[model samples]
Target: MATFALIHGAGDAGWYWHLVEAELRGRGHDTVAPDLPCDDDAAGLVEYADAVVRAVGDRTGNLVVVGQSLGGFTAPLVCERVPATLLVLVAPMIPAPGEAVTDYFANTGYDEEPGGDTIAVFYQDVPPALAAAAVEHGRHQSEARLGEPSPLTTWPGVPTRVVLGRDDRLFPPQYLRRVTHDRLGITPDEIDSGHTPALSRPRELAALLDSYVEAVARV
Candidate 1:
């Protein structure tokens, strides 16, 4: 069995991964989903990483750290403190040394803002009921989190994989592909969902994660 530590993106809590968590536990794997302090004024990347590390305390297993969206930034920091078997990024924001999240967006050429419908941009493929609930329950994210410089000097030495949503409007497939290649020297695998796959396509996401773990075990 493997342990999956799921880190959510900005403006989201661990509840965002509830579906994915259910799917993973159903497959007999251990899972931890930490609620990041994205809305708190005092919390930044370091605090975010600390929450994830605390959730992962003393777990002995094949540990995998999975990050989604802005979580891409926080997950690597956790890998620096913990022993992870692999790091899986889901539509992540790849940061350079001392780069802030705001700078990363501009650097990545994501020039267009959402045309007023977050559901269209983020949850196009999700079920309507779930999407509506998510929109209603979404929390306000702190802007301070975006300006903090990422503390990583280099990518963590653990094995890594990037997964992109083929229909993601927020971060298009081609853009993520280019960034992944330029930054991580790898290509991302694609799924048939939008930005928030854990809500829209949890089963598929879980299967892909399990497959990655199996593939890594063989090596």
Candidate 2:
């Protein structure tokens, strides 16, 4: 069985992959999702990458590293350190040179005030149930970490998969389309879910992970 390292977005713990993790394990794959030090600005990109590397333990056999949201920006760095078989980005925070996480909030018209709840970054047409869940799981992020550029330019030259949420509001569809297609030079698989697919669409998301592992074995 191949190993998969799952990373969650801002404010969310490793539990983000609860559903997907269970499904993948049932399918005979090993999965590890570590809780990132979300509240710590003391640890920057390298620290985040280190956390992921530790989660994988020894880099034996085929390993796939999946990063969601903010974890996306840091996943490539982990691949740089670990011998991952493939890198999968799910509705992640795409990084650029000299760009900060604050840039997204500034340009994307997001405000951090709503009766103590921060603005919802992704999912525009959210159902009431999903909206409430999203808010609870969402957490405020440190500008220092995101503002710092990703240490590595790109992930290893493995089979990389960019899975886009068809209805993600946090990162604009146009930008995700461009980065996944043009910037990264990878045609991503499409998922008809909001930003938090792991929470809402676990089986569908798990299937995507299974597909990636299977495809890599063939390669």
Candidate 3:
């Protein structure tokens, strides 16, 4: 069984992965979902990567690291420090060298203006009850962390995959496809969900992850 280290997006905690973690565990895989110190003024990408590395401590097995949204910036750093078999990015923010998350929006042609409705952007495909709970439990993300430049000069050597939410209003599939091709040089696989699929479509997400792992093993 592979150990899956799941990293959540901005303003989110490890609790966001509860559903997906349970699903993976049911499928007999070990999982680690660490709460990132995104709100801490002192924590940046290095600190985030350190947290993930600590969570995966001393595990010996095939390991898969999955990052969602802003967690994408941290995942590769973890892979650089550890030996991950695969790195999967879910509706992720692909950061260029020396580019901060704030700069990534305009660089990728993503809408940088604020004031969009959260429900329309993130919860469109999620269940109402769960989405409501997520909004209520959400914490503030630190600008210091988001504004910091990524430490990576190159992508990690680990095999990588990108999973795009087909209906994601925040990062639409077409936009993700273009960005993934240009940045990661791969075509992303699509899923039928919105941005928060771990909470909204855990079973499907888990199955997709399992398929990716099996496919990677064959190669």
Candidate 1: worst 10 consecutive residues by lDDT? 107-116
Ranking by lDDT: 1, 3, 2
TM-scores for the candidates: 0.97, 0.83, 0.95
**lDDT (10s digit) by residue, model 1, range 130-186:** 999888767888987678788988899999999999988888888899999999999
**Every model's Cα RMSD, please?**
1.1, 3.8, 1.5
Give the runs in model 1 whose Cα sits over 4 Å from its true position.
none
Candidate 1, residue 152: CA error in Å? 0.8
Candidate achieving higher TM-score, 2 or 3: 3
lDDT against true structure, model 2? 0.74
Clashing pairs in 1: none
**Which candidate leads in lDDT?**
1
Q: What is the lDDT of residue 10 in candidate 3?
A: 90
lDDT head-to-head 2 vs 3, winner: 3
TM-score of 1: 0.97
